[model samples]
Target: MPDLGETYACVPSTERGRGILISGDPKSDTILYTNGRSVLMLDLNNPLNVSVYGEHAYPATVARYSPNGEWIASADASGTVRIWGARNDHVLKKEFKVLSGRIDDLQWSPDGMRIVASGDGKGKSFVRAFMWDSGTNVGEFDGHSRRVLSCAFKPTRPFRIVTCGEDFLVNFYEGPPFKFKLSHRDHSNFVNCVRFSPDGSKFISVSSDKKGIVYDGKTGEKIGELSSDDGHKGSIYAVSWSPDSKQVLTVSADKSAKVWEIENSNGKLKKTLTCPGSGGLDDMLVGCLWQNDHLVTVSLGGTISIFSASDLDKAPLQLSGHMKNVTSLVVLKSNPRFILSSSYDGLIVKWIQGIGYGGKLQRKENSQIKCLAAVEEEIVTSGFDNKIWRVSLHGDQCGDANSVDVGSQPKDLSLAILSPELALVTTDSGIVMLHGTKVVSTINVGFAVTASAIAPDGSEAIIGGQDGKLHVYSVQGDSLVEELVLEKHQGAISVIRYSPDFSMFATGDVNREAIVWDRVSREVKLKNMLYHTARINCLAWSPSSTMVATGSLDTCVIIYEIDKPASSRITIKGAHLGGVYGLAFTDDSTVVSSGEDACIRVWRLTPQ
Candidate 1:
């Protein structure tokens, strides 16, 4: 039960990481489209429960509800787009294979009868307009010099369309046999997003060059330019126009959303909305939509922020949940308030200490977390999913964790005491040692050890098994010593830890009991039922060896002092919203804990 905060926020997609945001009818309530394999429709009014639809073979890049609100169209990396009736349980209407490469963006015609899809590949990126019902190509707008990033059809048109691309040009087209009418090259960098105003009189485009331009929809002439100096400091990724067409909204990599008045006033900035989440300019604002006067923006961190144009100063509501599952967790050595988590879908998130809560750094499209080991310098994570991740505090800013992958899926992992040396992973089938990215040794265990721990001196190692046995091995040779086997619990042992002095060892059971043993005599000194309601998942001993902390499925933490009996120890109830999966004591007084609730909690222990 790893905390989700660390793993998800750290590994995110660059362009499509931020999920598509849609608006409900004319009600102004937002509709969020998210998920890796399926399309999830989240209502902004509820924000908690969601409606899911469309099981795709690949991850979805974008989804849009039909203009009439009767259908939804979604595209994926496989160049497939599916149209579904959005009203009745999202029934599938039609599926089409439009391109050979990734489908970047899609838009339904104002009448909800046609779809326009664009993308890039071997040849020129194609913008093909198709009839939704028949999957027949209606027209093709084929003059983009590079991959197309976005495309949209004018709301009221004798069939007018706009397409933006990596070539930094916004191409305008017209007709049922759509032909390129004009190409606006005002954007300095890749034009990321473009949309025609509701009235079809104006169009707005955003780019990676930290600028946005408002152009006449018909003439394709740039009328106004919004620069970083006008309140944005980073690349602008998305732009939207208000319903009345008098205001424009833009989201940027600057981590803020700004609204500009289209009225004839010396071009002054109107409203600026800073994201509520704690992130710097690099946390990209990638998706946005304006429904009525309310503005909704989405970031690379997976959190959606909503603001009202009328009240920019008020704090916006934030949405949080997992689009994936947790994989691993590692506690920081220097800062008990910080923890790293990785997910099965390859997302990494960093949790930092805060007043009543903690801040998070979520990266999208990261490799899955495989194994985790904490050291003084950083927390290292390796995955069968093919990635070696590092969360370091000294070098780069504590914004997002970085990762690299070795050749294969990591079966097991451990860190060596020696600098620049990494231990090779051994599997349950065979015991092998990998050093310097190469296999060095192979040994066989009578029974497979699922979990292992290296001694502080690096001279000895202890491996635990599913057979309820502990095998102690000497690092110098393959020889092993069978330690005392105390068989009180009926289930397999989940976790084991050695004290700082190596004099005492603790073993937790699947039945929620902990047994403290004297290492030399191999005698069980204490048998404590710490969690009566749930199984114990992890255990940790204080640095001073005065107390022991145990995390359990009951969502509670208990501190057992060596001098005090287990029954009389201090208990911290409700330590995590979900079952606590891991715990670490940085010192005698500070403890860090992570769990399935997607949160890491830090507590201070004093003589009370």
Candidate 2:
């Protein structure tokens, strides 16, 4: 409701394990990648024009652009394959349950009418081919006893399919109801990737044996092999061919991606791509793709590095963000450029709007962060680890950080900047008052805490509890003494936020009900203001203090105007791929939010 569209997008795809899909061709500058539950299409020429098709029921594992470029064939973890129109209309052409397990890889034929998919399916650990528009079986895949890891289609006709699997074998197939043509026992370890060159004259495969083999695309004869001695220090994971079918890009577990110039130039070491101190073994470069002028590689740390032919050794654009469920985000009024967000994976990152990723702030808790608040030079966060952490923005300039253990798991945090020494922590045990890493006092609410907010004056504190009740307490310097209880909600309270001007406060409950109450008297101002149909997850107030925005499980964000209460509501349904979990207001009213979709979107409100 606040905005018609998103201004800028924070691109961060979840690196679930090793299956990172980057599919595209040289002619078309756009490359498709899986981000959260949606398939992202980003134009190499115009990165800002990222299109997200997010109707997948399960997390997407593989996405392939049809040869015709008019259709998209995608497979998910649920073993379901969906062929949909590529025009963003979400027109479903066909759906097929190709396997009973995760689909590891899928590719469309050169003709673009049929697709072959394979993975760790039930006992049917074989590749299967079917027509794109109608779920008609086109062929069968066999010879691999273990899970099929990757598959590729020969681009220039004669219709050939190559598949590699955990059985350490590569099988070539041919025909309409495809039959096995030849089985090559080339790798000593599990084969990880199988890819065909653009010319269809040869193909390549890499395996966990730390080797990569090139083969004749038509005859299935091994042509060459990239040895472990000089190829890669660690096992190879993926292989992608250049558009001209002259160069091959291979990513490995050794934290490097290499390009081998073949054909006209003979076998030569073209270049080496490495991020010296990016990380340890955990930051293995797992996926690589070549798109015309640039090459994109993914790191195990979920970092995307784009390299150009002009500068092969140095990656030009390295995009970094978050990769798990974003739990909390805070944007400070003073440092408008810095945006801080914490995730369920115990990750905390500081983002600069104009730049990419700024830096990282460490957290003591090892669990999901519930709430975060910024104070002058310090940032305080509470988490499911039952602890309150004091994080310094810049440790050298700010004070050192400290952690206070709460008896019960903390769920939310509320800080009154006016009383810098006081921190209000909501836990399943009760509402605790902490004075600089020490518990001043606690008031047991007898219910689990969901959300909390402190008055601008720091004199009163309101906590939303699991029992759908509001527990109001009078703040006495460092402790909170229970004052009263408001029990109008029928469901657990999800969010509570005080207006910027302290004139009113809003509480959103799980029942999709959001109520605005008078801050001074704690009396309901807007009762039964219901626009959402699902559980409310987050709520934020506009900088001007006249409007309130709420995000819910319904995948919608609704903004309510205070002055024009009755009819001043704007609704942006399906605002996020999944339900919205965290929302923060930017300086210029750009509502930044993160959700199950694993993407952080900045919606630019169309001025009303």
Q: Pick by TM-score: which candidate is best?
A: 2
Tell me the alpha-carbon RMSD of every candidate. Answer: 10.8, 2.6
lDDT tens digits, residue span 1-608, model 2 = 45434322344353433545578745667777775677777667655566778878898887888877888887888999988888858688888898899888999888888788989877865678888777788876768888898998888878788999888999999876788889999789888899988889988888888788889888888888764445887778888888888888888888888888875423466777885443665478878788777888877766767888656756467665666667677787777666777777766777666553655564444456767788667888777778888867663233466888888887778887677667778776778888889998887777788888877668888988888999888877666779989989989998888888888989999999999989777788876578888999898887887778888889888877776673568787787766888888775456777776656666777667
Worst 10-residue stretch by lDDT in candidate 1? 2-11
Candidates in order, TM-scores: namely: 0.59, 0.93
All models: lDDT? 0.66, 0.77
Error of 1 at 493 (Å): 13
Candidate 2 error regions (>4 Å) = 1-19, 263-267, 354-368, 395-399
The residue-by-residue lDDT of candidate 1 on 309-374, one tens digit each, is 677788877654343434355666566556665555554555554422133444332446656666
- Candidate 1 wrongly placed segments (more than 4 Å): 1-28, 227-231, 264-267, 321-325, 328-448, 451-608
Residue 337 lDDT (model 2): 62
